[model samples]
Target: MPDAVVSGTVYDGYGREAGGGLVLEGGVLARVLPRGYSGEADVSGAFIVPGLVDVHCHGGGGASFPDDVDPRSIRKAIGAHRASGTTALLASLVSMADPLPAIRALVPFCESGELAGIHMEGPYVSPHKAGAQNPAAIRGADPEELAAWLEEGKGFVKTMTIAPEADHAMEAVRILLAHGAKPSWGHTAASGETAAQALEATSRCAAELGFEGVPQTVTHLFNAMPPIDHREPGPVREFLAAARKGRAIVETIGDGVHLAPALVEDIHEWAGANAAFVTDAMAAAGMPEGRYALGGLDVDVREGAARLAGRETIAGGCSRLSDQLALFARRGALPFGQIVRACVAVPARAASIERAKGVTLDFEPGKRPNFVVFDRGFSPVCVVRE
Candidate 1:
């Protein structure tokens, strides 16, 4: 006998949707029934998608991850994103002089299963493209510091963002792979050739280590990097090309503020499942427009966009992954199925959270039930996890 059943329009975490009913048993999806099958809960027209996975997010709910080390503040941030339907998340910390303390602070959450892992977005990036990062903290790649941070993470450091053009950056990439952590290329001014070289190095290293199917990502593509020019043709061109070929998964802040709807649509058309949508969200997400902190910098939020105080450089996002889904749906940029894959499956695969034991986000038999029910407007009506 089933513990419970939910009948609705169901979307497999990949790119398929059907009208059916899901049977829950022993805290897992025991069966998926065809349409017209009656159930204990009938959602009729609502849309059911796998719970969202955010690979890059600083904080939310009025708490900043990089600035707060308390477990309570961390839980507050996790609770905020979780309320918006993000079941799997990586607590991203910005560049700092020494990140071991912060990495230590986040490892408990990873052990307790409250967080998927930790993402360190660099002290090893190009100063020329630092974006909102504090300039004083930026430095050349240091393999020693990288190893210390990863060791202190206790195997919970899943990703680190590095600039391909930074000194000894390739060495740093090799170190991350050896430590079972993936490298994300961003905050860079690297030329197209340099970007291609880094991608090849990561691929070769991953293959040598037998780490097949593990994703190498471009952190929030086109945000801090140089724009593509016909003659110059910087890293953006190479990153997009890699994404189109499935060689890399590119993270796009699809909040409508970071990327125009048309550009987002174009990227999706080119990259398809390889374009992963991420929030890169900060403390202001789910909160009223006001002051917030993203690392060492103070930010002011107004009109739904967060920016550094007294500057125009856009800070991290103030929208959740669900809000990005709604924005893309409203723009009619891509099919709802594709958008769901970008927000759910792609990021999960990139972060390897989909492979975590007892945590598959699909509605497949024997997999734990982790999903969100959204109305026609794409607002989350119900979120379920087991």
Candidate 2:
């Protein structure tokens, strides 16, 4: 496609939303326009930010990422995510089996542009902190099994969700980092000490084992992970300390239910661009009230909140990425730049893709083809770009 000219308030990397414009071409940014230049999107007044990204997500709408769902269903899920403003995302497959077989199954999706990558959220988590994951599938990562999954993923696995409390978790973290997969801790009940040890191992591996990233992240700061109490610091504390030292990151599910809005503001203050908001979305996102599947069980998406189909378990399900942004904008008491940082820059930093698409995301040599028009309330009025 040729370049598309967009006119509106452009939010370049979390700064005050600009009232200028930009251009998108060939699926990349092509140009950043100035005032009084109009061609494509005549967004007289609207808020335009970079496309959003979701890391730890499950099913969305009524369809779940089950073993039986065909390729068509998965594509439908991705479309639903896009409608919610997620331009790029990882297809997070909840660990049902050993995760190797599923990784092989999902390779086609990632390679074909159906997904960004895989997020193995179990098979090596703590039975106690398993959340809604089937405990029967819980087990330490055997070297043989790990090798099998990594090989099957074939570069499609972008993130690893591990149980920091699992036996030899640190060792497995090393293996994942070695395989070019960014590892984050979750689905485990690790204490402050274990999380500390995991980040410690990450630092050592980066220094001696020739790895890249350091101080592996803690997924979902409080939920699933340990909490922090001044009396005794927990895994959350460990993550805070590492981030404070510019070593680690902390990911959060910004849905008002997963975390209190007040804490969201606090995280942005401490972690800055390191605290990322993950959808942790399941299959019920963008769908009406109904039952859905995740890994191997049924879930219910009622009144826009996902819970166990029949039980009171609040196992995460599909929720829109835009809703996360809206939650912060409404409840976080933050300005435009702060909200944009969590929605754009923060996620980019976590995935190390900031230089490519966030506020500082670099454009190709030609032009910056971009778009998105929203009103004063930040609601989308129009969006059209390559």
Candidate 3:
């Protein structure tokens, strides 16, 4: 096959180079030509980087993933992010009474590639830290029911978030690991001690199952989880310690609305590769400030923050992964490659898609052609998914 070359200041997922070109042949990245190399460049004048992957995204374009079983809504949600350089994403679902019905409906899309998979955020989480999740839908962990729902996705259930302090939470973690899904700790008021215990149990399970190097993650860290009270400490401290030691990965909304600018910089520096960024975006994302729906609840998006209608509680984010990238670029606190690592590389590895289809460790021959091009201002100029 003839090579299709795109040249620019290329950041090949891990490191950045001054100028280079990506070669694509047979629908894969044929090779990466370094600076001064002679290659006919077909695309230029932009920053070329790996396509962003969002492991935690609810919906966008006024389309809610957890609101309906309609495939049209699902396509709209996926399309919104794909257009913004999020070439891959998991369709996150909020807590619900019976998630199997929705999970089943989404299976075809997951298999068909419009969606990555399902991320069940609850129905089994701490009521104390439920945040925007429906309190009435929250329930104690039922391993049997969970196992049934896990199978309903037919391998599309990629990850599930559970509260360490919730009833039978450990059992839920066990079920998640046994079913080939990653279990993340979130939406909890669990003390640091309890969070540590949960980590210990998951560590033992991962070791026994030979899932090493796969660190346990905390969802949208410091948001639904307990805050750092000097005396109590809580999950923040424990999560940070594990992240620093490379035993855990922490997901930050990074939308600025969910975390402070300084804190985001600190986490990126402290956690490094263990730092994973997520959008946790909902229907309001990519839409103008207005009303939207998330998990059957009304949400109001104003000034770039999505909140529960008529309440002060923040529902989720109103930004895409591209917007988050622009947010980081504006700060200039971290290097360009580091920002891509947190937003793309780390999340892809966590989601087990780092070496999956349309992804490659290097811009080398025989790798699928998937990447993004951003203008100098950090806005997504083009996305090449071929």
Tens-place lDDT per residue, model 2, 1-386, is 25455566677545455546666666466666765555567345456676676767776755556444577677787777777677666677766765665666667877765566777777787787777777788888666677678888886676677877787777787777778776777776777887787777778886676656543666677776656778877778888888777677778777777778788778878887677778888877787777777778777767666777688667785566677777667664767677776766666666554433212333233744333455666666554433
lDDT of 2: 0.68
TM-score on alpha carbons, each prediction: 0.95, 0.89, 0.95
Clashing pairs in 3: 28-367, 29-367, 30-365
Would you list the clashing residue pairs of candidate 1? none
**Comparing 1 and 2 by lDDT, which wins?**
1
lDDT of 3 by residue, 99-192 (tens): 8778987888888776667888998888998899999999989999999998888877878888888889878887787777878889988889
What's the ranking of the predictions by lDDT, best on top?
1, 3, 2
Tens digit per residue, CA lDDT, model 1, 1-386: 23666766788778587557677776678887786665567444367777788999999999988998899999999889888788888999998987777888899889988898999998889899998888889998888888888889988888889999989998898898888888899999999999998998888888888785754899998899999999999999899888888789899999888888789889889988899999999999899999999888999999889999999889999999999998888778699999989888888888777765324456778867777778888898777765
The deviation in Å at residue 373 for candidate 3 is 0.7
Please state the error at residue 45 of candidate 2 in Å: 4.7
Q: What's each prediction's clash count?
A: 0, 23, 3
Ten-residue region with minimum lDDT total, candidate 1: 353-362
TM-score of 1: 0.95
Alpha-carbon RMSD, each predicted model:
2.0, 2.9, 1.9
lDDT of each: 0.85, 0.68, 0.82
At residue 56, candidate 2 shows an lDDT of 72
Best by lDDT: 1
The stretch of ten residues in a row with the least summed lDDT in candidate 2 is: 355-364
Better of 1 and 2 by TM-score: 1
